[model samples]
Every structure is written in C-alpha cells, then in structure tokens.
Target chain A: MKPFEDVGARAVMILSPGDNIAVAVRDIAAGEKVELDGRAVVITAPVLTGHKIAARPIASGERVIKYGAPIGKATAAVAPGETVHLHNLTSDYLPTYTLDEGHEFLKEQHQ
Target chain B: MTIQAYLRNDGRKGIRNIVAVTYLVECAHHVAREITYPNRDSGAHLIGFPGCFPNAYSFKMLERLCTHPNVGAVLLVSLGCEGFDKGRLLEAIRASGRPAKLLVIQDAGGTRSSVAEGQAWVSQTLAQLQNTPRVEMAIDELVVGTICGGSDATSGLTANPAMGRAFDFLVERNATCIFEETGELIGMEHWMAERAQNPALGREIVNTVAKAAKYYAIYGHASIGPGNADGGLTTIEEKSLGAYAKSGQSVISGIIKPGDVPVAGGLYLLDVVPDGEARFGFPNISDNAEIAELIACGSHLTLFSTGRGSVVGSALAPVIKVCANPDTYKRMAGDMDVDAGRILEGRATLDDVGREIYDLILRVANGEPTKSEALGHQEFILTYKSFEPLGPACFPSAA
Candidate 1:
C-alpha cells in the first residue's frame, strides 16, 4: 500500500492504477491544484476529505472506476478534478436511498 | 501458540465460559433482562428470541447460541402462551451436555416471581461454570469472523484492507477465518469467484451474490445507508468493494448461512441474506444482527472495522474494534482497539496494523478484554428469518 504522504504530498489518493477517481485525503478547496499520476489537475469544486474527485474527464454513461473495479456509472459528463458523487454518479445494481427535506427516506432511481 | 480455553462436549473450544439467560419470546424479555441485571459482571449475558410466532431460523440460531462453546450453562425464560417451542429448545440445550433450566412466566407466577426464580438459576449456574474444564486451544482451532460497519471512504483504504491483511496472516497460520455480508458485496462476485477453490464453488459464490442483489433490489434499497453517503460513499457498489476488502486474498473454501458451523474451516463466506422471498424487512436490521449471525456460526470472536465508528460488542463473543478514520479514532479511542487510519496518515503501515490486530486476537483469546468488552458492551439481538440448507457445492473442500 502506498502511503498518502508519498502519493502527491497527501492531497488526494488514487487507490489503484486503473482508478479514474482520486480520494481527497484532506479537505481541498475549489481552484486548488492537486497532483494525480504526476500531473496537476485544478479542482473544479471543493472536495471534502474522503470524498472522490475525478482524476480525468469522464463521459456520461461511463463506468466510474475505483479500487480497479467499476463502482457505478456516471450520470452526467464529469470534468477532471470535479467532485464525483450522488448528483452525477449512480450504482449499476441497486437504487440508492437518501433523506428528504422532512427526514423521511426517499429512493433515488438510477437514470 | 496455545491459549487456555473452555472445551465443549462437541469438540469445539471457547474463549469464554458464559451463563446465558435467554428469553423464549418478547413477553419474557423483561424478566430475563432483570434476571441478568445483577449478575451482569459475573459472565451472565442476556440473549433471546423476541418473536411470539415460531421461526425455524430463529429457533436454530438460539439453539446453536445456547450450545455455543463459549456458554457453560443456559437458563430459558418463556412466556407460556407464545408459539415458540421452549420445551424443545431446553431439551436441545440439555442434550449438548450443558446444564439447562427453563422457567415459564405463567407457571413461575409472573414478572417479579419469574425474575427472582431466573436470578437464582443464573447465580447457581455461574457457580457451576466456575468448574468448567479448560483446555489448550491452538491457533488452528480458532474461528474468527470479520465485519465492517458505519463505513466510509477511508474504511476501504485503511481498516478493511488492514483487516484483510490480518485475515491473510491468520489463514496462513491455519486459523479458520470468515467474512460476510453478501448484500454489501454485490458488485464483487466475479472477483470473489476467481478465488474459490473449485469451479463449482465459484458458481455458488456468483449465485449467492446474485441472490443478495436480487433480495436487496426487491426491497427497493441496497445495503448502503444514508450514513454511508454522508461519509462520502457514492453507491452500494463502492461500499461493496470497500466491504469486500475484509476478506483478504484467502481461497474461498465454503459458503455457509446463519447457524451453519463450518465443517473444517479455512475461509468461509457467510451468506447473511435469507433464501427465497424477502420475508424479512432486511437481511440484517442492524450491525448487531450480523454479529449474532456470526456467533451462531460458532465464531469465537469478531474483528469489527469501522470508519464512522460503532460501539457494539456481542454477548457470545468479544469484538475488537479497528478504527479507519484518524479523526474518529481520536474521538472514540476508548472504544477502538486498533487505529488502522495510521496508514493514511503515514504513522504506520498496513502490515504494522495487521500484526497488531493478529497479536491482539491472541491476547483477547487468552483472556484479554477488548475496549468494548472492558466498557461493558454485551449487546445482543436476535430476530426472525428463514433459510434453506446449503447445497453440496457450497462446501467443495468437504465434498
């Protein structure tokens, strides 16, 4: 396992060689430049620690790869360094559930 | 290395000699709890089936729990009119060679009287348990289960994989290791199948995961929760890949369901999701349900990996908590056993944490109490579920 400190100075972590998303090791603000695979990518949006940031531009309907496997499919085109999450990516196998404004569970279908 | 352990009649060894106070139905739960209250620190634990209606799965689980190697005696509390077959359960417990007693609420004169009667039985049983024989238990005789709860992105990166490393170390030493939660392992079937010992077992792995996916799909929700999303996990597949890391790279030996003891353990995949229709609300209502299922399968202890953090320990076995996120570990260090998040911080390597976990297991097996155990976390929960027996392909090695 590569230590976070050795990987691009610990800003973000790319888990495996084929992973298209890098996990933010620490909170990163928008407009901050982070190194991925030795190349710097400008952050398009603020990313919280443990949240995913795109390592490369991804087309809509493309598989989002992490841990060298497909975690889900992109719902919209994603730019490099953009936050990748519920708003833009969805699981290929099951519907994800979240709370509504009233704190009741509401199911979000995969598009 | 060997540790002193309680030897059971069935040839299994245990790290604890606990007196179980079990309730046969929901009505008896209160009385049973009251009975165990005063004797709580004396290795007396409360376990029970709260359902009034009979369930084969619940009955089988409770019977196995009562006969678990960790238990030296059992006291059954029953509400007389419930559909549960308390008499048969008591008989099963007695047949296991452990001292067993039953108190029917209606027959024992209701609440106050039943609690008093149950407490007397527990006290006597605790005394009897003092004489339970101790034998040397080797590493190979150990059955260890691993689970991840309240997970986040760091869990996959830290605690889970570190646990996977510990599993590898244990499996290499000929110890029996089990990892489960097929519902959380939905997208990783093909990878897991590749590690199966045989082609047929590979097919069984795929089919088992397929069953879990179907079960969750029917419920219109995956195992990934709102806490998972809030913790930065995007979907169930992502959560699955993270959860799957706890299994390590051991060759898949067999697939067993709740209450099915592994014939000879190397590595076993526990299918927690029920068979047939989704009669139960979810495969596991909470993390404790999964822990109970692991105990029912004869696990001596469990390694629980968490990022968001969980503070639960099982009644039948000890739980060692591995914290994945450094921040959470700092906040809950008193409840956590290992700080796997050190890998991310570069304070320690995965192998370092893995060795620490393995050594801690031996210490715990030899009579060390984990953080949760020390804090008096004897959480227990059992609910209704259904299952069919395993097919021949589920255990290719035995075949």
Candidate 2:
C-alpha cells in the first residue's frame, strides 16, 4: 500500500510539494481521529471531501496557504485542523464584495 | 520525425499557408465577407472584431492572427471612423513580411464601392501571396493549443487525457503548446503548482490560479459552468483537474497573459482572468474568447475536446475536435475530428486515440481544413476590458 494511504488517508493529495495542506480525499468528520505522518489529529470541522483545511495554524493578515502558497489572507486567525473557507478567509488582492460594496465600487469606477 | 514547414520573417514557422480578411469593426464586416466569399474556395478565411472601441488587447490579438504562421496575407476592412488603427495594424503585418492591404468603407464611397475595392485588393494580395515561395516546414515548428468546452465527466476520463497525450507528443517534438482558462483551474491550483519546473514557479502557478478564482467569485458566477454541472462536474476543482489534463504532464516552464507571444517552447498556462478589477464582466464570457487568446499567444492550431460536443473553430487557426462521449460523438461525428468516445466503446485505447489526434494535428497543419473551417465558421467577438501589465513574478523565467 502507498505510505500515505497506509495510515487510512484515502489518497495523499498535495497541492504543491511546499504546501503543508493535503485535501481530504474522502470526507472527514469533526473530532474524528485521522493520522498524518502517524500523528493523530482530530478533524476540526465537517470538511467536505474536496474542501480545504489549514495544514498549520495561520495568523490574521498572514497569507492563507494552499497548494503550499498564498491564495488569500486569513481575515481572522485559524487553527490547524480547522476548515479554511470564505467565512474566515478572504483574498487580499481581489477582495470579495457584498452587494452594497459592489454597487458602490461600480458607481465610483463608472462615475 | 520532423515535418516540412514554412518559416515566417519573424522567425515563426507555419504549418498551413492561408490568407485572412479582417473586418476592423462591425460596420465593414460585410465587405470583408464579400472578399472572402469569392476567394472562399481558396484557403482564405474571414475574421474580425465587431466593436468600435480601441482595445489594446483586441489590436494585439488581431495582429497576432494577421501574422500567425498559418496566414500568408491579410486584408483589413475598416469603417472610417472606428477606433481600430488600420495603419498600425497593416504595418505590423508588413513588418512580418506578409502581404497586407486596407479598405476604409466611408472613405472609399459606400458598401458596394468598398466591397469592389476589397475584392480587388484580396485578389491582388492572393496572387502575390501565391507567387511567394513555400518553405520547408516541420512538426517541431508547430504551435498547438488545446481547449475543452461544454465539458462533461467523460472529458477528463477520455478526451482531455487523450488530448494531453497528443500535447505530450507535440511538446516532445519541441512544438509550442498552450492550455488556458484559469477560471476553470480554480480548484486544481495546487495540483498545477506541483508540476511547475521550480518551487517559485510552482508558487507563481498557485498565485495565478488564485487570482482567477477571486475574479470569478466576485462576479457571482460559479467558476465551473452550468454545462459542466449538467455533465456531472461537482466543483471547480473537478472541472480543473479535467481541464488541466489537456495540458498533459509536461513541466509548466512559464506563464503568460493573453497576447504575450510565447518566447520559449514548452507547455505554458494562459492566465485568462483580467489583471485588475472584474469590471468588464467574466474574464472570458465564452469559449471563443479563450480560443482568441490562444491564437494571440501564437498557436498554429487548436485541439478542442468536448463531451457535450462543441463545434467551435477559430478564424485564424485550424481547430481539431476531439469528442469525449461515445454517444455525443455518434451524434456529431461529422462535426468532430476524432472520437475519443471510442475508449468507452472498447474499440480503441487512449494511446491509439492519442495517436489519431497527433496525426490529425500534422495533417491539419499541413493544410487540411477542419470541419468547422470547411463549414465557414469564422466566428469572432471582442469586448472592453482593462488589465494592468503582469507583475515581475508572472514571468519569473523570462528575465
């Protein structure tokens, strides 16, 4: 059996060799114990099969790591083993918009 | 293993010898068509943008098409007051040593007058272009691009990977290969980053995809399209994994934005998302927009993989359709080049289908018209958008 799978991880999916995070090949429930490098860490959320989680703890304003690089920044601190998603994270470069923000931005740009 | 090719003045080699008629704005499109219609039997194609706006990207893409290796000459049709700079565009073609002529409808008199003038110019250009000697071409001199549209689950399983194999073969021969639609690459960023030749490049790959995801997310559209969902794609990552498969397993040497002619030959990802705010709308509103970007990057031919089956081909380059679904191929064989669906039919191996695509690229590059070309599908559309130049990190290897 593959070394990553020997520990019951469905497949060892790496975003990049530099990335600390490996997406769950199968769904892992919160508090369920899964072994990484033989070290047991409980699932912090109901991470869907393909959604992302922190491979390590990230500080606010720090680059949110995925594929081993910064995709966005943590708007708030996130602990390792917790779900990293839109709720707590946002792209620093291309910021997400609420309806009001979009309206205001478009008005300013066009005006 | 090298095929014979024609090397252009700019040091690019052509697989096909073609003449193109370009309509600068929507107004002169008919005159451009008239010129191409009479010379239609020849390897001449009609291409143009419909907008009157002066878009730097549009000018750059049109310039690329006019001087593409496959094109031997160009005829420009202009409505006198429109913003497309015909003189500058013509000069670019002339600098490339290809025959080029321009007709301004308002200046020439009217529609009938312009059509007559355009026809005359095209005939003259065609004769001169024909008199130009053909040069030896090769498979290694080719620039090929692959794009998947209306993709379904079968795309990744058969068509995409099969096309990837063909890309691998092309890249092995030193042919330039391009695959794009970063919006589709949303979830597969990490998978793509790992394939970069270096760690920084790997990071750049991830950054490139992240930008695209953010661009699409702001527009309130799913990165994966509706057709993708109907075809069984669950998320952007799944679509990306399937889409990225068309690039084959080559190390992505560098990244380029649209209209940046490839300087090195290897598999490169085209960053399709606009560089700044998502003001003009979705990065690429449709598949042809993606196709245009590929051409702008110097693709001599395109490999189109479809599961639900798209029959789109570009005006500037030949598009080889590889259908992934057996049932779709069965329903659309006349519109397709290779039925990768045969893999599911149990009648062909992926390698066998790949070889078919490989051979098809050579044949199309050698002057065989694709089904879309034969059917006179020279569709083109360009819209307004702004982008800041790529950052230093975008082309880490270029320097």
Which is the leading candidate under lDDT? Answer: 1
TM-scores computed on chain B for all candidates: 0.99, 0.95
Instruction: Give the top-scoring candidate (TM-score).
Output: 1
The global C-alpha lDDT for each of the candidates, from Candidate 1 onward, is 0.89, 0.74
Tens-digit per-residue lDDT, B198-236, candidate 2: 778889889888888777768754555556645644445
Q: Report the poorest 10 consecutive residues by lDDT, candidate 2 chain B.
A: B229-238
| Poorest lDDT segment (10 consecutive residues) of candidate 1 chain B | B341-350
The C-alpha stretches of model 2 lying farther than 4 A from their native spots are A1-111
RMSD of each: 2.5, 8.0
Model 1 chain A worst lDDT window (10 residues):
A102-111
Candidate 1, residues B161-238, lDDT tens digits: the string is 888889999899888898999999999999999999999999999999999999988888799888888889999999
TM-score of each: 0.96, 0.77
For model 1, name the residue pairs that clash: none
